[model samples]
Target chain A: MSDQVTPSPGKRRIGVYVCHCGGNISDYVDVDRVIDAVKDEADVVVARDAMFTCSDVTQEEIAKDIREQGLDGLVVASCSPKLHTTTFRGVARRGGLNPYQYTQANIREQCSWAHTDDREGATGKAISLVRAAVARTRLSEPLEPLVVETTGRAVVVGGGVAGMRAAIGLADMGLGVFLVEREAELGGWVGDLPKMFPNGTDGHELARRLQDEIHRRPAINVFTRAEVVEKTGTYGNYQVTVRAGGEQIRLDVGQVIVATGFASYEPEPGEFGYGAPGVVTLADFTRMLDEAGSPLVYHGRPVKTIAYIYCVGSRNETHPYCSRYCCSAAVHASLLVTAADPGVRQYHLYRDMRTYGRHELEYIESRRRGSVYMKFADDEPPLVTSDDGSLRVTVRDLLTGGDQLAIGPDLVVLVTGMVPRDNAELTTALKLPVGLDGFFNEIHPKLRPVETVVDGVSICGACQGPKTVAESVASGLAAAAQAAAVLKRGVAELDPQVTFVHPEACTGCGQCVGACPYSAISLVERGPAKVASIDAAACKGCGGCVPSCPEDAIDLAGYTDAQIRSMIDSLLVGSET
Target chain B: MTPVPAHAGTGRGPRAPHGGGPRVLVFSTNGISDPGIDLAGSSHMHYPTEVVVISLPCTSGVKPSWILHALERGFDGVFIAADGEECAYLQDCSERSAGIVERAQELMEAHGIDGRRLRMAAICSVCAEPFTRQVRAFAGSLAGLAEVAA
Candidate 1:
């Protein structure tokens, strides 16, 4: 850690650099004019324009100025701070200035690139941006990252295929794992499935293989009929309590992986003739087909013709998203049915065929095997009815110019989609955010897919959203990798930008307590007074508590009220074209 | 107006512009809306050069006075890029921000400032095009208000 020399407010020596970005900024914003305008700003000791501020030569020059001029603060007028904040912060550190005393002016993204038609306007804006940055920097102080020690352990929730795989992965990495399952056994929905797609592997067999691997690892401790009821403490040092059997078991772990999987959407009774004589869910029908002894029978009658209803519980009002696995599941089932009896007629009534990726091949093969697919309009869903001893499905076939057709079939299968498992208790325990779609929300779907807003916690598998077996397992490994990355070093550093409390100013009004989402703030008795205290590790630094304090007791560090007012003054005072 | 006791540091960028059109001061969140607006610039999307932004930790952290202060300090408009449901910290950030906007609007009205000059909307991390579209639309409305007054 670099030593931080506190610079007094009036004596703050700051270096300001305007970057050309090789005309990325200079072409639109006159860099020399920006430097000229901000050269005489308060606390600014050195101001200059650079062809490339991030270049090694310019960096050395800035470092030399920081050392020779004894600069304590820095303002770099360059591209987005997102791109080069760290580079110049390192420059500040090497120059004996605290890194937090540095700030960046996003001239490229906010000014130059945004105003290509007006160079004079861009230059004036760049000048103001630099001055504001200098103003913010004048109040900037050194900040040290909050480092939390880890327990070298992880808790995997769900006990599904994803959870099992994640447990095995964590165990292999030499981390102790607590694999918790709400059920009596390991395998989740996959265990109940007869077969899965692509490899055509028995779903139960895949679950068994993962369970065996987990059992073989002594580091993995399985807790069946157990669930994490509460999670406390900060990242890399979490204390979780699992409700298992008839007792509460507490464990200290570094990370938690939510591979909670998902539940299949069940239709309401009488919807799509769901409770009819011959109608059954696709899950029930598939199991029947697997154990049908070469002849599919429903209600003591051999099934001659079968009609499959796709999207019965999905693509509708209740469930809007398509269950990504059902199309392949149904197609794979049809191939199984064709192998059993080529004489049996199979009809697929549905909307658009979304058997994406390799599953599309399964769709074509199912078609070549004489499985007729009928397109149905979204508004006009197919209807299923039961009579004396028969089942019939009526549908408007859009492919046949929207012709309505009705036929009786021995068996009717309702193709259901995946739904989020009822995890209100666990969701509350972990404080995981469920999306508007009721699925676990991640930070970013593509960039940081597995991690959640809660530090040391990540979501994976169908619980995040519907996914094929392969995709589920892929996300499972990603969550394991995320947990490992944070816990491997046995220490994790949280951003120091998190909230802090001013004890003397705090009236103990408790308004800030409710405003804090992480529950990091609490009112504590200090002598005869109650004051708000902030736990730095738990605070995410969203600043939601700042304005909620009527006493103005709570304020952010770098974005303090004084700095903002100064920046505002710098922008408006005698500032015009 | 006092020293930050021995505690954590807050990180943010404060940006202001000088140009034509209504100078809009947007209080954008660091984690959510700032990146979205940056995406607009990287995509070479153009808006009025006068739309300056002061990045905040969260929109809920913005005091109502900050909004009124920007307008009182010669800014024609004050926009808040709230962290809606995509907020990483609080679940009710948008609601809190809405309350701030309401109070700020009431304050603006008391000061005889046009309430239409202030606005608040959710700006997600990936809402780049939406951010640009919002700035352009807000700038247009502020310009219209100026014309009507003239």
Candidate 2:
């Protein structure tokens, strides 16, 4: 294995340029002092500085140096690589050097910003960062980009609120979409819903309209009772095997979305008599509303008095999170009942009326409408009794000086919360990460709301977390916008900072392939030793495969460890001298 | 009515109000944090004289872009609010938000929009009060600016 692996040798004739950034760095740290310090660094044939290293004029200067001086390697000491690493790399490429030969030093946020009060300390840290980049660049090698042709289509999982909206939005953008729903019908959980609050729009109508629109659009392919069985390939080109209606079908697409909306909360056995006849959940209520048009006329008798129990299988010691949507749902349920039978007395029993957001406004409105709200402490929960023949709920009212109020009515509505699907088979197959609550985790809660850590994959709706119909639709649209934007460009842009595997150095023990969390690296040719090749689009620029390569034949394009560390060394040397 | 605070720097751009009049302050965070406030000129906000522009930063750390946009909207004043500073990496996000609000006020006075109309303030999640107050303040500032123009 050792004999099979050797580092890709670095080429000679290197050029180094330090950017003054128009005194952004020069004013704080002595740019000339740093430049003088690294002028003779090993393998560094020429060194120079400019007022604005990122300017077009400076790029011309670097280009001229590469052509005239025959410089093979390039290093730029300037702002953080995040800002302008691509600019210098482009300059290097324009100057007849492979873009991978260039490296950038981030002396701005990591150093200058931190050490503004202490010039000496800032200079020292800047030098260390630059030297590290220089050391790493010496070990850098040219890497090739793997290009794959896309089928120009996308697969969207789940036919719920999220999936349907994303599908409609994407189809509207002129992209072909295969929207797969796991159930017999589309519209995830929202399909069963009666009415959406605030606007009071019919839920079923929205789903039907969307379904009609999707059906009308030639680009959209809707499949019911479908599931993705196997998935492979990289971003902009994915091979997926889906099982739909007992038929196994394969598809090749450019992108995929998992909008698999969450399942309704199914209380474990004996946890609140969840499955009992009288103990109906929120979803059951939606069904009832759809079927009977009212919770009041249950079994054909007008419900004189009804008690709504909030937070079923939620917010207890077992489940820490307050299923965010329950309060609003409960409030909406109360309004729905009032609309059904105006005379039905609605009593809402709960621990806390956490009617957050616009729901608070609704809560206040509900109160004005004479809906009774009774709060019960967590330890002293309200009691539910169907054993006495009639549905009777007993609760001690905190507002009424400890007096217990017992209401016997025709029915009791249990406002159950949403919970993630229990079976981990599907999530495991995709290698997607789940949150503590088992919902799919987004890349960043704020920054990358619709995007997943895996490129070319986005998630929306309840699959991410509990949200209202409006929120779910908005999220679905956002996800669609992002995915559509990518396809609209007609071509995916590689990071240019990805790693490449040298086949000649192949001791490919398959270690690096396994080390990649993204599953971007794979064994391309399996023989005496498997040949490791990186799918460029799938590789996330995470240097996991670099250190794991036992033979050290693997190297990243832009910011290789050798390149970054050498730059760091150059900065430190400049600091000392 | 008192003017709202300006958060970023003050300025007037090419899109400033025709006849150099006061304009509405439109603060948008690219429909991410403050999706509730529709700058898209939907039926809810059809203020023809009102300017509408989207922003892409946290409701915190609003830049001079807010000030310039408000003046450009051609309303006598401006109002800006959005998501709170929960996960912002920009240090002093609220301060930046406030800085730009102040700068907007300065620009409004210089560009003839009543400075009172250019207001910036913190808006909590799902609460419409801050937004409502800013709208009322913008209207009042527009009235004040109209009186000056008249």
Candidate 3:
């Protein structure tokens, strides 16, 4: 395999390889028929079928053909490009041809698998797809991938459990970390909790342990009362501006991790008699339990009876999502209260119980301790009426077939859910998508859970969605690993298909500059008129600016206007042979 | 399984000297719609083979001249698979591509080509079933138009 190829002007030597995919494609569509149909297509130097073209041995064979057949262009009729596009491109590169000169046709997904019942039609479509690739290949030119330098530092937004854990993970990977916390304290909401569910671990102690770990790391830079005001540049080299302690500081980092934890749902005043005496939120109750020693006392009075109202502001018309962790938290809180005062009786008025995972043990314990649990319908909520320094809570228990149960207790704790933090400023600055639920939306919920659509930026913890402490920590580690992967190579290879400006054709009207989402285009003076110049590193190859350019000056490298037009012509109109 | 359409020939169609099926050109965005098309194939969802795909980086990158050129060169219908908000390239790609399509439709009317022959849809990377359904519907509409023209 050599990297040198001399092509005769106006002539394209193309090789076509059809993969059988081990009968994944062959059983449905006739592979040899496709090869035979496209073999005599104009400029097709060779056509063949393989059991599995993606195999290492077959790739080597294709490379061997590239050298011996003098094929200037190649096409692989196989699986989706998402699967093995880079694989075949590597083969093309080894064959001494420019990787960009190769085109991949989806014969498996778009033809063979799709029209399995119609083999003849599928084969015909495969031939046409290959023909389209060949036509496009004739117009493709060899291009090199753009290599961009990377910074070894990572900027982590929010100093919650996720941020702290991510910072530690990055530091462990030998990368410098800038951990930014909006509040003066490093620990987020986790620092305020009295006791965590399942394991009776002190939330503050857990947060402090993480904070101590971060403090001990030499590579970690802690910034309290800080916020990332602005962020610019691409994946490998990002300039972030942090406003901390009344001064602005700039940091250049390779990646960014968003761990801005969620905000606890705050119930409105008079909501379920929330502002009344003896009526406290679950968060307030947790702090009260922490402050008041072994025997829980509210206002110097020993609390003997307590009623916990579940789903205060969640799973309603206003907030449609279940705060996932609230049910388990409620159970844990009931158990804590039971442990504090063995004589105290607890009644929990709730919706559907969702004590999932290991938290089920705590739920069982709460039930074993004789804490009364009642289910209430969504439409008919429990009514809390205050009369003569005592609370009267009447709920139609769905479990007992609409039997109205009334409980009068000394104290009422509203079990509130987690709400998304108001990250409007940060969201605008980062240009990240916020879902209709007001949480940061990951690119894909399952596949790329921690990764945002933006390159080099990751979202985890409560910011992405409501997550438990353990899940938050796991997401933090995942984000840290993602960031480390970006900086691990010390250099990033951007897509070679980024947009470029034709200086001669550029009118310098600045339309492309405004149209560019990444600010990759800028106007520069050329002779008398200014022509737009593209910063290839900053350009994400979105081609948004291409249509904005009135003079047709801007075009992406791989999907050039001519190449795309040729492909369209090939599909709609046959090749002008 | 539905019977395969008669116009699966290698030659360009509808107006091809050897008349057969309606030739529909599908311009799919590489990042989103192209993968969706692949998923459609992987899912074994069938649409007409007359619909040939031309993968572009984004539908915003498509020039109106290319659509007009395809129409002039014996193509029947053109489908632009625009990536909505999920576009990796630009935030306002849907609106921008819609503007391009609208302009192309106006140009098609001026060129004596039926503006209805041009269709634009926002197909995400995961919308394989929707893509096949859209293509099948578009192909059906084009086939009806071809019968009327004949």
Candidate 4:
């Protein structure tokens, strides 16, 4: 026990603060008992319990104690660090102690909340948790965050509405923007849509206006028919190579925004009489509407009665997620036809009417124009048959309680949902994760919406998920704000909890090179042996390569072997005293 | 100061047998498993407080020696909450962590400890209910083992 209590260089005065959380933790775990249990532990000079430790008054009280007692370290037995780690760290910093010297013991989540019925056990575990924090902080060393300069440039991928908006937003902030589009035209899916909802704005005209604005900006560089060939470097310094017009162009930027738009779902042949004469997809019908005159005509015939099938190639075995735009699109299409020719009959076959938000007005208007809507079940989808040079649709209506409805129309339009673009090549080059539905996954859908797991890159638009045009544009602006915030300060602070290599123990086996997922580790010549060198800017601090080293030569700065061993020992043995 | 225990059947140390009940050490990753555990707590799901959690940067950073050290230090079992596919560290995080657990089990068996004393499970960030159920089941299994030994 004496050997476990290693003497520190300074006066090892420590303070511990436990929060009641207004009986959220107090009712389950005895807070006063915990304070009494750890007050006499090794170097604990001051131990107290608070009603709410995160409150500003309580934080000030903690700061006052730190200054009056001359404390060197602190252990806050409170909620998970995920919520208040930074808040308490700031308390420590204001208390004239290094923020890194503090440790947050998760008593609320792992102890009081997990063991509500066992107060004695929760108190005992809280003591153990605080003891582990004390043990870890006794060996904790003050660390300074790393600061890197920003290049004041950004790379915007996929020049759709989202990408165009992001480029415009970034350029408006006086940052050089490089907008890359894989297609020759910049509008993407929006360029093909005839008009948008709510006010009947032309989609192509909106995209053309954005393109004109982008072309007029001097700081924005537009690259049509271009693709990102390679991306290297870390946050604040990224070298992006783009292949365009049979030439390779390299751009040095600080941040990247991936707004690669979505692809419309294509139905299989004979799935919905798709190969028949007048059967067309919603995209195809919209294109025809854009080209046709007032009276809608298809296949050189005046279209009178039309049948629209919703959720085609979506909400099925192959595609389980709702495309989120199909129901509204179908309703809008029905309204378009009803407005063109009031005498024409329009029938909408859907599993559910999800005409959400203001689009419900269009749904109401479509119904007022004498359009018929029939709901179907998942198991009994609408079946289309082409016989005798005519198309017939059979669907079991769930609304009418298992009644079957039949409709034969001049044209059948399949309301296909949005599918993720084939981002296999881009996903590999960017090293981003794609969800099971094939869309790019964000770190946290609500908290870190546009940000990817990668440090410097972010994702927005339909690439992340099925988004409406307004939602995609909002996501684009949000990503632009995030990027601008990153570069606005002209410097970024990196967490000091990165990997470090000890030259004396390294065998130069080169095993860590393959173990590193971020390719942050490299071998550098040191004396006669080549030791591992980690790029602090590029390292994600995952600590994967730490265990891969056969000689145990590598260790993370904050999570060292000694620190973890001490924590484990403290968890089992309690306090050394 | 007290001498360290030789093995499970050898002798008693400070933590060799305590009235505090069975102690389980949990090694949870900071990214995925730790958050899941927190969610379990935030949801007010109750479990045994005998479990103590230590946050790691990644489960791949766990050393076999550390597992053996916890077992020898008086912990009845060690539960490694791995990150699995959601590991921001590596794509093959589960496979790599399973490799470590395999080696640790071999070391445990060689040292006269039951290989089942150590367990590994993948807990993602949103796996709150699954995590509570897993911990409850694991604790029950350990309790059953203790009864058998008695």
**TM-score of every model versus the real structure:** 0.90, 0.65, 0.85, 0.90
Tens-digit lDDT track of model 3 for A502-547: 9988778899898876767889889989999988777767677887
| All-Cα superposition RMSD per candidate | 5.4, 19.0, 5.5, 4.0
Sort the candidates on lDDT, descending order: 4, 1, 3, 2
Say which docking band candidate 2 falls in: incorrect
If ranked by TM-score, best first, what sequence of candidates would result?
A: 4, 1, 3, 2
Between prediction 2 and prediction 3, the one with superior TM-score is 3
DockQ of 1: 0.43
Over 4 Å off, model 2: A1-109, A112-120, A137-145, A273-277, A293-295, A299-301, A306-309, A314-323, A342-357, A372-412, A422-431, A453-455, A486-490, A502-508, A511-577, B1-150
Candidate 4, DockQ to 2 decimals? 0.49
Clashing pairs in 3: A109-B41, A542-B89
Every candidate's DockQ is 0.43, 0.01, 0.37, 0.49
The list of candidate 4 runs beyond 4 A from truth reads: A1-11, A316-318, A360-371, A574-577, B1-22, B118-121
Angstrom error at residue A416, model 2: 2.9
Fnat values, candidates in order: 0.56, 0.00, 0.53, 0.56
lDDT of 1 by residue, A1-577 (tens): 0122233346789888888899899999877677667666667778887889999999998898899889989989898887798899899999999888899989998889888888877778777788789889988888888888898999999899889989999988888999999999999988877767876899889888888899899999999999889999888899999999789999999999999998877778998998878888888887887678666677687778989888878876777788878888888888888887888899999787889888899999999989999999888889888888778899999999988999789888888888999999998899987876788988777768999878899999999999988888899999999999887898998878777777888889899988876788998999998999999888877777888888888778778877888787666544343
Which candidate comes out best when scored by DockQ? 4
- Per-candidate TM-score, first chain only? 0.90, 0.77, 0.87, 0.92
